[model samples]
Target: MSDAFSPPPSPGGEVSADQRQMALFSHLSSLSGLIIPLGNILGPLILWLVKKDTMPFVEDQAKEALNFNITLGIIGIVLTIITVVTFGIGAVLTVPLGILLGIAWLVLTIMAGLKANEGQYYRYPFALRLIK
Candidate 1:
């Protein structure tokens, strides 16, 4: 049994402070979607690719972040298509639903970052396991 004072263990042995920070960044990077097109996917992808060789913890967190963001992006695209195709009628439904999902994404991503910062493996409850 582990004591409460001990830090959480990561899958890849002892996680360094740098690794934890990178992992946290991996999860938080998804928020960049608000500024750059496809940034949600690209941010994690870049981080994962750049650090996967050296930081296993970061790789794990980045993959989770990437997959979750990808799933959210797909859902968002579908909602947008529905709204456009229905000529604003779908907005009555899709808009509110989209907003809710957006909030969920933000909340969940923040939670994941906190977990990663604590040296814990965080998995998205709804993310598709498309990356691995």
Candidate 2:
């Protein structure tokens, strides 16, 4: 045996796959509130700053969740601005846009969450991947 002690690898490497899967799920739980428009991005965004290197899968999922929430929030905010600037013309279009975006956000978030919960890596379509 080696004379000096060595710390074990991160959970993804050292723990059983089941434990790794649970870690991913716990990370997702921290993001549960993010499904609600602005709330959807807040938790994940904050968590990303703190947990990225601690776990790769969690980092990926959290980043995706944050991106998804931020995107939705931006679109909603922009649509609001457009509605105000265009004197209600933008408002007319905002409804349909909101509907489509909302549905897409919900589906994507749920899919991401469920997959993570199921112990699989969930990748979002059109998500900007910050971690390799």
Candidate 3:
């Protein structure tokens, strides 16, 4: 109700590009498979495309996360098929494999987000070279 109680305007008078890029990086890291899904269609696609030239490091990291998740999904799908064809024995194998893959992906994504926060590029292992 008082001028003194008003929140301060943004320090730069406008949101900086770095701030925006970091925000996208953070969102993609958490979203991973849930929001990213296949084809890198949503969050990953936006981060990879929109942030590229403006924020190369964050964009690359987002792309890495996207590639990793898509790879994971494909691996899971393949294993599922194998499981069905093999009459469920492969299901047990694929389940644990999938869990390990998920854990590793989570770790890599978190690391990428941390590095992105510090303004560094993080490359993921087993990531396909999808975004150029």
Candidate 4:
């Protein structure tokens, strides 16, 4: 599966600092969820659309970020529905599960940003490969 996550070839041996910063921004964009619902997905989607052609690294990392955030958003909605359907009984489990998922999303996004800033590709484990 390493082949699946491998970065697209760079014509030069090293990625430039500007490319790395843009890639980092793609991952960091997810934090905008705090200000707007689904902003996490929208932020990276916009960045990817604007920069993907010019930056292979940004394309790969932005796509990964979008896929992961979308997956998490879906899971969170499912858990919320379970809580409601169960008449709040499921809240005992679902609430904490949602919190854990949020925490994981936050932590992992930060880590991905750091890796991208270093000019290394980072793939989020357990993210559904929903976007090619």
Candidate 5:
């Protein structure tokens, strides 16, 4: 993990303090999954939709967060189906996979949020860019 306080150059030129904070919130919003079902997806989606047109940095970060969450959701659904089909045998795989995914989501989300807060852009590894 690099310095979370360093700001990266914005694609649309200079970034404002307000834009950086909003972008940070957009990335952090994914953690809402811990309390609300699909809240991770919803949070980023709402932030992205609300800010994309106004802030380029927020738009990029929100879209990145949204795409990563969507990919994770798909993986989770597939894992659930596999567990169901195997009649609990797949729990061996699904359980660890779920744990790993959860940890990855948490860590990556925090890193992204920190980077965004610092005005830097962070791309999630292994995330499907489904939303372009």
Candidate 6:
């Protein structure tokens, strides 16, 4: 394994098939949120924690997914609060906005997964990068 502090590896650069698969799964794990609450964050968090020491590629991808999902989760909470404060009035706008947010999250996540599967590094454009 390479030194952890070294610069991130290039796409398909010296990465084995196992590493690529793990990275791919790390990104796709966010889909767990579809069935389990906060699964998006939890999935990546668990994977990252388990593999961070051994798989740098998986660590990077999982951190990206975790950060992105966390940002979206916060936005969702704010949206829900707004809708509640407005007593359903905000729903008129928040509903559509929430749907759009979900769609965007899904699309971006799938894109990231595909990139990871292809041995490419993927960074979400809007992710907050909160997890370093």
Q: What tens digits encode model 4's per-residue C-alpha lDDT throughout 1-132?
A: 446556556656787898899989999999999999889999989988999899888888899899989889889889989999999999999988988898999999999999999998888876877888
Q: Please, what are the lDDT tens digits per residue for candidate 5 over residues 47-124?
A: 999998988899989998999899999999999999999999999999999999999999999999998898888888
RMSD each, Å:
5.2, 9.0, 12.3, 1.8, 4.6, 4.6
Where does candidate 3 have its weakest 10-residue lDDT segment? 2-11
The lDDT of each candidate is 0.88, 0.61, 0.61, 0.89, 0.89, 0.87
lDDT (Cα, tens digit) per residue for candidate 1, span 16-103: 9999999999999988998998888999999999999988888888988998998898899999999999998999999999999999
Clashes of each: 0, 1, 0, 0, 0, 0
Instruction: Tell how far residue 124 is off in model 3, in angstroms.
Output: 0.7
User: Per-residue lDDT tens digits of candidate 3, residues 76-128?
Assistant: 78988999999998877888988887788667776666655654445665766
- Order of quality (TM-score): 4, 5, 6, 1, 3, 2
Residue 47's C-alpha lDDT in candidate 5?
98
Off by over 4 Å in 4: 1-12
Candidate 2: deviation at residue 32, Å?
5.7
Give the C-alpha miss distance for residue 111 in model 5, angstroms.
0.3
Stretches > 4 Å off in candidate 2: 1-37, 128-132
Q: Weakest 10 consecutive residues, lDDT, candidate 5?
A: 1-10
Q: In terms of TM-score, which candidate is strongest? A: 4
Deviation from native of the Cα of residue 73 in model 5, angstroms: 0.4
Between candidates 1 and 4, the one scoring higher on TM-score is 4
Clashes of 1: 0
Candidate 3 stretches with Cα past 4 Å from truth are 1-32, 35-41
* Candidate 3 clashing pairs, residues 3+ apart or interchain: none
* TM-score for candidate 4, residues paired by index: 0.91
